[model samples]
Target: MFAFCADPKTLEGAAWFACYLTSATHLAMYWSVLTVMLLLALAAPSALMFGFGGALMARSHIPPLAWVGKGYISMVRGVPDIVFFLFVPIAVDQGLEYLMHVTRCADWTEPVRRGADFVVCPQAKIPQSTAPAYVHDAYAFALALLAFALVFGAFAANTLKGAMEAVPRAQVETAEAYGMNRAQAFRRIILPQMWVYALPGLTNLWMILVKATPLLFLLGIQDIVYWARELGGSKTQVYAYPHPDWRVWYFLALLVFYLGLTWASERVFARVQNRLSVGQATAAGEALRKAGAA
Candidate 1:
């Protein structure tokens, strides 16, 4: 903020816009972009880990474990994403509070589900309803991240399962025949080969994940979309910086932001795809080899 910003009504043209942009609220809006990025950065890996576990379970020798894993993948992916987006965070939060209530407030005799209000001992409340602002924000973001991970993880599991199955059965058997155990064969042959097949599906998943960042608003996090609406709404002249409805411009900025994100993501995935295509038997690999030879 500048001295001019102290009385924003006196500012005009670029100066007015400059001060407006640098206001504390605008800075928070800008930082919200980083929140989206952090979610993606964290969620992608978490989803992959969950997917890997699910895929392993789906293919497990134990019938019950395989059923549970397959069921998870089927159930999550089969359900509509919006439902999960709305449902998961609330369910997880309440579930956690309930568990804590049992442990921390065992002596409390009141029913938790009191006429549709999910009440718990105040001591068992997550963040205790009295923690710092940042703690509440962190708790909300963590729940949103978990929702993303669970939904995306199921989809990733399906993709990975197909990729794993796509590896040739003969090759696996031959590798085992040549003194490699099942684990060694899987690590050396199947694992390396599956990526080329998996990359395409995984790349699409990444894009979908990127697009879904806007859903943070539904999860109680004050994300960029929330800021855009708050800051871009028309303010009357009674306010220091009066402005007409500028939501169009704010949303246009969002459009450009997302387009740029997807553009950068495509370039990254393309490079990764090309990198994975080197020196293998697939058509893309063969083409890459020829290109290298030339």
Candidate 2:
């Protein structure tokens, strides 16, 4: 911020606009791109872990565990992701508050739910009602992240399950014949080979995750889309940075941001696909084989 930015009123033209763009709020808005990226970074691996668990459970010899795994994978197919995105955080939050209420407010005889209201003792509040703004924001973010992980985890579970099955049956049999137990075969042989098959589905999931970042707004996080709508709205002369409606321009920038992300992800996944394909028995591997020989 320049000295001129101290008085946005005196400024004019691009300089005025530049100062406005660099304003504290706008800077925060700009940094929200990183928030989206951070969400993806955290959510992707977390979801993958959840997916791996689900896939493993799905393939379990035990009937109950197998049913749970299959149910986990099948849940997404019947339900819309947006519905999960909306419902999961509230469910988790209320579930936590309910548990806390039971543990911390046992003396209170009042009902936890009265009509449509969900009321809990102050001690049962997540981050507490008196907590700092940042604490509240962080709590909301954590819930959103969990929701993302659970929903995407289901998709990932399905993909990983198929990938596991796609690993040649003969290879698994050979591992078993070589004195390897089921777990050892999965770890040393099946798991390694499944990645090549899983990579395509995972890549698609990554792209879907990127697009879905905008839904963070629906979850009440002040993500990039939230800032775009906020900053693009008209500000009066009394405000530090007065501006006309610029939602179109702001959204165009978001479009560019997402396009760039998609392009970068494609390039990265291409490299990863190639790397995973090395020495595999697939079309990509065959191509790499001929090229290496040539």
Candidate 3:
């Protein structure tokens, strides 16, 4: 920000525009881009971990565990994702508070759910009623992250399960012939090989996750979509910065942002896919071999 930014009202043309853009609200809007990035950064790994666990469970010998894993994947696939996004935060929040309420409000016997209202004692409030605004925002963001992880993890689980099955049955038998147990064979042969099969599905999931970031607005997070609407809406002369509706321009920027992210992701995945195919039996591997010989 320059000295000229001191009096936005006095400035005109480019100067006025610069001062307005650098204003507090606009800075917050700019920061919303980082919020979207943070969600992706945090959510991706968390979702992957969840997916890995689900996939492993689904592959387990134990019937109960396998059932749970299969059920999770099936349920998530069967349901709409927006339903999960809306339901999870409220459900998790209430579940946490209910546990706290049982412990903290044992003596207070008013019904927590009386017909339409769900009430918890003040002490059981997440971040407490008196906490700072940032704490509230952080908590909401965390809930949104968890919801994203759970939903995407199911899809990831399905992808991983399929990949695991796609590994050659001969490879497992070969490992056994070499005196390797199930666990050893899985770690040494299956795990390494399955990733190639999984990469395409995972790449697609990443793109879907990138597009899904806009749903953060539903979770009360001040994401880029929310900022675009807020900042691009028309403001009158009564406001310090008055502007006409430029929502089309704002959304165009978001469209470009998502496109850029997807393009980069595709390039990265293509490189990874080629690298993984280097010594495999697939067509890609044969091409790579031919290319090397040439």
Candidate 4:
């Protein structure tokens, strides 16, 4: 910020605007974008891992495991995502707190659910009552991340399970004929081949996750959406830089940001799919071979 920015009250026009934009609150707003990115970066891989586990469970020989996996996939599909987004964090938080309460306060006589209140001892509170403000925020964010992962993972599981099954039965039969066990055949043939099939659905899910980042506001995280609303509200003469409601512009910026993210991700995923198909027995690979021969 320039020296003139030191006296914001006396500043006007572009100088005042620049100063305002570079203020502490605005800096925090800028950093929140990175927070969103960090969440996506961390959550995507975690969700994929969860999805892989779920898919394996669905394919398990154990009937109960298969049932549980199938139920998880189906339940998520049937419910509206926003409902899960709202419910998952609260449920996970309370569940954690409840477990802690039972462990830490074994002698407490009070029932946890006394008319809709989830009462837990102060010692069992996540981040603890004595913890700093940011600790509470971080704990909340972690819960939100878990919620996002669980919901998205269920969808990913369904996609992966279908993809895994879509890998040619003939391939598995050949592997078995060669004395390969089911596990060996799955590891050597199915896992690698299934990815080409799964990539499309997974890419779509990634886009959906990107779009859903705005829901961080709903989770009480101070994300871009929250900052947009806060900064874009009308400011009166009582403030350093009085302005009318500019929410439309703020939202428009968010739209552009998301559009850019999706567009870039599409380009990246397309290249990855092409690379993954290079030596495969798929139609895309066959086409590439034909082109190379020509």
Q: Whole-model Cα lDDT per candidate?
A: 0.92, 0.93, 0.92, 0.91
Off by over 4 Å in 2: 236-238
Name the Cα RMSD for model 4.
Answer: 1.5
Model 3 misplacement above 4 A? none
Which regions of candidate 1 are displaced past 4 Å? none
Local error of candidate 3 at residue 248 (angstroms): 1.3
TM-score, candidate number 1: 0.97
Q: Which 10 consecutive positions of candidate 3 have the poorest summed lDDT?
A: 1-10
lDDT of 2 by residue, 221-263 (tens): 8899999999998988888887789899999999999999999
Candidate 4, poorest ten consecutive residues by summed lDDT:
1-10
TM-score of each: 0.97, 0.96, 0.97, 0.95
What's the CA RMSD for each of the models?
1.2, 1.3, 1.1, 1.5
In candidate 1, what are the lDDT values of residues 157-226, reduced to their tens digit? 9999999999999999999899999889989999999988888999999999999998999998889999
- Candidate 3 residue-wise lDDT, 1-294, digit = tens: 779787667889998988888888889988888899999999999999989999999999999999999999999989999999999999999999999999998897899999888899998888798999999989999999999999999999999999999999999999999999999999999899898999999999999999999999989887888888988999998888888998899899999999998999899999999999989988888999999999
Q: What's the ranking of the predictions by TM-score, best on top?
A: 3, 1, 2, 4
In each prediction, how many residue pairs overlap at the backbone (N, C-alpha, C within less than 3 A)? 0, 0, 0, 0
